[model samples]
Target: MNKYFNIAIVTALSVAITSFKGNAMSDLSQYVDPFIGVDGGGNVFPGPCVPFGMVKVGPDCGGKDWNAGWDRDGNIHGFSNVHVSGTGGGCKYGNVLFAPITGNLDMQDYSSPRNNEHVALGLYEVDLKRYGTSARLTALQRSAMHEYTFPASDDSKIIIDLGSFLSSHERQYLVGSEVRIISDKEIEGYTRVRGGWNIGEPYTVYFYAVFDTPSDDCGTWKSHRVEPGKREQYDTSEPTGAYFSYRTSDKQKVTVKVGISYLSTGKARMNLSEMNSWNFDEVRAACVSRWNEILNKIEVKGSDEQKKIFYTALYHSYLQPVDKTGENSKWISDEPYYDDYYCIWDTFRATHPLFTLLTPSKQVDMLRSLLDIYRYEGYAPDARSGDDNGRVQGGSNVDILFTDAYVKGLKGIDYELALEAMIKNAEVSPGDDERKEGRGGISDYNEKGFVSTKFERAGTRTMEYANCDYAIATLARGLKEKEIAQKYMERSRNWQNLWNPDVESLGFKGFVWPRYSDGSWWSENDYSVFQGGTWPDFVYETFSWELSFYVPHDVNALIEKCGGKEQFTRRLDTYFSHEKWDQRWYMGLFQISNEPGFLTPTLYNYVGRPDKTAEVVRKTLKERYNTTKEGIPGNDDSGSMSSWYVFHALGFYPNTGQDLYLISSPTFEEAVIHLENGRDLSIKAKKASDKNIYVQSVKLNGEPLDACSFKHTDIANGGTLEFVMGSKPSKWGTVGVENQL
Candidate 1:
């Protein structure tokens, strides 16, 4: 764990009903790391936007290469309120942050040489000659919490420059508010924009802004400032900067709050009213309250620091997929319908599943949105629902996710409609050439059936099979198509093709058999091999070592093939005790850094050596997920990685995305989940941690728990789990793999 970052307790438990933040903590605005989404990498943007929001506050430092927020060389561009770092589409709104020393507005006083502009927690200081101001910014969510001790100058005030709206969805109307005493906060107005691939309905946004100190031109209405030669049509006054009166003082303290909503101005006003003034104490209290309450939903008991890491990461995981459409269900993207976030094609995997635990309403809306996409576009959203679908991030992901949710009991989606979408999706693979009766793509179903990775294609293997099974199984279960389900079940076993019989491992040599056109083949070689450098030690010419252990549905099959339980036990030992191969591919070998490998921990159950699984679970949870830039190994793919940590920490993982959680190793000694239903799943782990990875014994509901698969039924009913843990595996739970088979 890096000492630079501290793990602080969340403080309270209150949902943000009236306001985004309830009580103890600050507003969602406070905890948001604007820089998180910076092109620093991936879709990460280091802007002022709330997590995953389009309203990013950073510099105009020219695209990504020039850098943002900080980079103040002559490369130093002006600041903008809305921008995306590592992403698509043009920028929308940009409200520049500046300290004005009463002047004719200067734009080029900054330097060609980048200098001190280091941003961090509670601090955002910079030396800028451009605006003839040395500025610093800070925040606590509801309140901007700024103490910008600008250099002593003549009459001056920080400018809330509405240079541009991040795609016109931004509304900047000047309103009069006397801070704590004012009633109306926003300038009764809104801006409109469209989103999504085919261009769905446009959205109108209303926003209310609050300032800490009383302003001179309080009530007078001001129009939005537009730059010359601008094309978008709008009724607005030319100048965009909002001016307030104040004399430059040493370390002057000021606060600001921005309330945004897709509803009418009334709703936006309500948001401001609910969160009045820039009261740090009040807002922080509210946010903290909401956090604590939701956090308590799954109460975690462990070292304060570890708890912080878990909660913080968990917090980040749920930051987006926000309730943007409002209660009535209407939303617009900067790019309009063509890029509406409502589409489920992308979120199903990492996004939707994580939300299933806390934000079901949002999940409902998402499903409805997918339904809308199909109704309007004549197609259920798949991999790339935008300008092109062939842009394969893998389309089957959505189908698999739909099946996962349907089986898990989410209501709202039309069964028939869902079936049609799912079946149509399955019948067609993303890139297939030949078509069949049921299959949607060009290739016949046989060629794509579960087979060797060389045949099915590695990246396309797991999900294709998963979705095929999903289509058949969902059809069977929803309408009793058992034979179809059986067919898919057989198809799902295609993962077996990747399993090499001779080497007794997942893939021995031609793991690269199906190879690709880029010559990149099946394995990763160098650091830049994959995006984000393979998420920790995920880099594998073949597969991350930890990932190779995955075979969730048929661990016993793997165990039997590896030789009996004792021999399988030896192989397991070899896995846990092995070192990196020194080759570029085997770097860090722990597959925990990858996705397909996520289910590896639960594999121990099929083999009968549950304790081994538990020990590794404990170790990985401790070592791999430390709080640092390197904290999580992979794309976070949304929250899959964190969810993995949370579940494993609690002692089990779902074997299927459905109502079946297989008991696995746990980290926390005592973890309790306060389900929304008033039921509580309490886990008591005695002697658990880095040293105590093995379980000496286990007891669920006080019964002699012999085997290791815990059902969702047992957990949802809410009960106690007690595991006597130690550093060494207990012989009692050491059932060999081969014998079980």
Candidate 2:
């Protein structure tokens, strides 16, 4: 670890430890460093939120377009009420902003040199140095509590902006808005915007704001002050809002609660009713308790730095697919409502499986939400924000998410309806409706067994659809729906059609290459410039060679395609040999920063080379991840990367949607996962250290397990998995036996 990381870890440990000084003991949330990904490509918003809560309350530094809200190098624009956690494109949510000022209005945006900044799970606080003010934030499921302390001044004012929703690629505007001064101490209003992450998705956010101490003066402003004590209705698309100037004596702390709802202002008020009093400490404590309940699901014995990374990773994992069930009981049925799936393409790989181990009940509700959305909206939602579905990536990938939950034996969902949704998506062509509900080029995929370059990113789309097909088939077979299983199972092999046995560019036989509608190759000279900069869109942010290894459901078949095991091993060696990363290519052959490349490290286990898997996984974690602001190599993608780290650090990975978890040498001495089934799965990496990054041998419940993989039941049923670690790789888990798919 570097000096900054050491300082960060020690400081985090000190806070977590010192929090227990006056109190009897401490909780895991204390060690969470929300700032780890703020500066890094992690692109994570450090803010106040409960686990899967609908509200993400945080500061929006207003970095031109990047979303995560807070930027280490940017100025503090104002604190916004909502944010999409760890996403790439432009920022989303962040409507209903509140900023504090003293004395003059100071129309100039404050350059907040952040000080005394501390953030844990469910809580965030920062001192605005320029304004000499402090802001602290905590959240409820649908509401947020903000406490601001201003210097002794009578001019302390709180400004509420109803116009600026988070900046996006397509700038969002307040098409219509209404502000009502409900009373001397309360106000209720709402704003409507049409453009967010899903460019044309309409979103209307309602908020009910209340103050502990009534303001002496209140007025409405649009670019400038307009009226006082009057309910204002603004129909034009312009910057509009209200401000409450307080009459404070000295260091008067004011507490404010804002409840948000997608339903109506009444629902927002009801959401705010949960905070019965103006007790900031009480609300803060309650937020801490809620976070602890979730973070305590896992316990690990490791260095303070390791613990910080693990706990923070877990914290980031639970920040999305927020529960919007409380939005309005009337608009949505009694079924669960989850908003901001953001993108299922980024999440299904690890986030869903991690939920299976930790919170299976939430997974069931989330599945129910997907089904409900499908029943009402004619299709399951993929990358959604608020209530609208945006352009999807990777071919109706929600099939993979729903199927992953169902196959895990989770209850309380309409499985038949879910399967219906999956099949409907699989069969329906994309152009059948203007909304683009199902798979694009599905007709072509079904007829030709492969998608042609006629559609953009044909290679990426084909592989993603095949994976979804495999997941659906697996669920269908388990449910004894053999006809559905057989149909989709045949479709799952469509990836084989995209394989070109003679790819001169890759200097190998049988690599996945794009072809035109007539089965002619669409060749590009430099495959390294696959996407990103200085490259035409050859692939969707991935090299054809990297995606060629994307047959997750049937890696054995992929091995066969590469001319058996020996040649496959040589290819794997060549893939990892390139240590240099070009700007055109985000990362090298094993793009640890991206999702398609996540499962590549685990491919070694299939070739009876679990040692190589162990080596690669350990090195990736050590070099690519850390406990700093610039920690992650790329966007966290709503905790997909974080969950990837959490599982790998525990010495296992859910390499696919299936139940099998590939094992490796854990970075921790011991890690314990407390499953929802009231069982404790303990992973003991004995003699584990930084130098000891290889698995010498393994045992499950005192029985020698020779295979490199274990069933999900092994963890869910819960028992001890012990691994003897060594400085170098051992023969353990290197057996040639492979699990039949």
Candidate 3:
């Protein structure tokens, strides 16, 4: 039972446990609940996407709201082909919408009441109330297949609206657009959207749409006029496009296969080659198979709800750093091209490491993609979408992501080129042309040893820069570049510059505070009430108090600086105790809601007390997550929060920029991590249950593994890690492990 229990039995059991209405070969994809993050601030797009595929075809709510597409209460406004899952603010990329109707053009607002929806890994369907039509959808790598069932009527029509965007931000970004009917069954177009995080860079997405059956009467339209026999349409007054009216029987299905590309309309046509046929059922089945193949990488044997939560998180995890390199890639290289990196600031903590564990091959391609971006654009992108860089969030943190991949020994990337990009990004400041590219305050950080309060997000920036420097140094050491390693390793300690040792409040000394360029502490105001609003003098999205514990690469050094183990323990206790655990405000103090405070709960493992870590981890698991529509605590942040849950549930967490995993009490009795290297790492907990949440002892390969942690290499090599569970905290993992870092 310690091993993977044979593939035949697993397959047989999987087939037995699932029975769906459609022709789905595997049932694993069914466990993924698309609604998990819809209500929560998870902000995830519950759409049809094949793994990291670009085209996320799903419905957008009518009107304008922050939830982008498909808010729980908002009316359904048809399906669109592009979206950013789990992000903050009003971002771009919900282009080219197609809505089906069966009535006269009396009401243009097809904001129908949604009902009887079926959402799977790569499938979505919802009944539109007013028209009594059902919209079923699926997708390929870069294409969307929509099958809209209409009632018996002569006015049955398919509307291709180019200006139907997800939010007002996307609409504002629309510079220009063009649509043309190629033939009776074919149409081609492009939309150019700028700003909305892309600044002045306009993103032109080309599309090729083909209908299965030709319409009886087809014509193009712009603004409010229905242009009969007009073959072409350009930018008009308001949200413009065309409509195809058809005489139909009851339950008539109008199918359309649409392909999108950032390169050209030809590339979009090339992408549509994956469809091969107009069989909607076949496409949906194929999508289900592909999703199952990816989701079954990690198999768990838990309750139905647990499996739902686990698979939903797993689904969210693969939503991005989308694979832009396909058969019809925009770039002229064999190396993989990945785009829509919402921001490494959110994902560098856990999401990237989750990829290392489950999809190392993809991780390699992602690293190569970053390097490729550097090769073409002259600087690595921060929050990129639709083939353009967005606004820079924090420090140049792609260095940390690259470093994480390199240390984990993921292959296929050019290390020399990666090292060059990392060093260049760290040392050089971006020119005016590339404002959101390389490190911004590098000059001040290098000279003054800290970004002053004068700079935006000064405290968080200093800590993030230090972490990035540490990662670069680690990569340099791996490549045997001794000089580069030494240079960056020294610079990595610059986080110490922000420590305000004189602040002794609430029995806790040595708080990290903001400082002036003249080396004086900017400690005149209160930081606990949150900054950057009326004050306009604080870090980004977080308080300095929360940002203080962010020294991930060198927590031991942080512990020593904060007056050793006793005082450090007191501060950690105070941080957690000060705030009441609310899922909404996971941003407040030990904010598990976001990335800034991810490593706080596990800090106890470093201070020779794994029991406290166990307590907090269990409490968070119990309180924070569920199987509700609003399951996730906050913004999934492109799966960062979901990945955080996945790792913690499986009983380990990757220390960012390092190869080590800090172990804790796992939620499941047994979990088999199917490694991409053709191996399986099984974790079995004896007497595991809700009550038995404390680890009594741990054994790696039947040996007493006294260390409360293990290296990434240990799991990759394959073995069983058995943890004995108890109802109460014991002496297990209390003393600590030497040289673990």
What is the TM-score (0 to 1) of candidate 3? 0.93
Ranked candidates, highest lDDT first: 3, 2, 1
For all the candidates, what are their Cα RMSDs to the real structure? 8.6, 4.4, 4.8
For model 2, the local distance difference test gives 0.77
User: Relative to the unseen true structure, what is the C-alpha lDDT of residue 8 in candidate 1, on a scale of 0 to 100?
Assistant: 32
Tens digit of per-residue lDDT, candidate 2, span 1-741: 011223433444444332212442347765788888876667888888888878889987746666777777677777888888888765677888888777666544534667777776666888777777788888888899988988877788887877766775656656776677777678878877777666655678889999888888887766555666665646465567777888776667888899998888888999888777576555666666677767778889988898888889998899898888856332548888887887787888889889888998888888888888888877886777767776576668888877777656677878788888898888876574423357777777877888786776677778888988998898898789999899888888889888878674445677777777888775655343234321124356567678888888888888999988998887887677655466333334677777878888888989888888888888888887888887876889899999999989999888556768888668888887777777788889999998998888889877988998887766677899999999987888777436445
Query: What is the clash count of model 1?
Result: 79
Candidate 3 regions exceeding 4 Å error are 1-26, 63-68, 106-108, 168-172, 198-200, 235-239, 326-331, 433-435, 526-537, 580-584, 737-741
The lDDT of each candidate is 0.45, 0.77, 0.78
Better of 1 and 2 by TM-score: 2
TM-score for candidate 1, residues paired by index? 0.68
Q: In terms of lDDT, which candidate is stronger, 1 or 3?
A: 3
Model 2 misplaced regions, further than 4 Å: 1-26, 106-115, 223-225, 234-238, 328-330, 432-436, 505-507, 524-538, 583-587, 736-740
**TM-score list, all predictions:** 0.68, 0.93, 0.93
Model 1, 263-296: lDDT tens digits are 5545655655655535344343444444444454
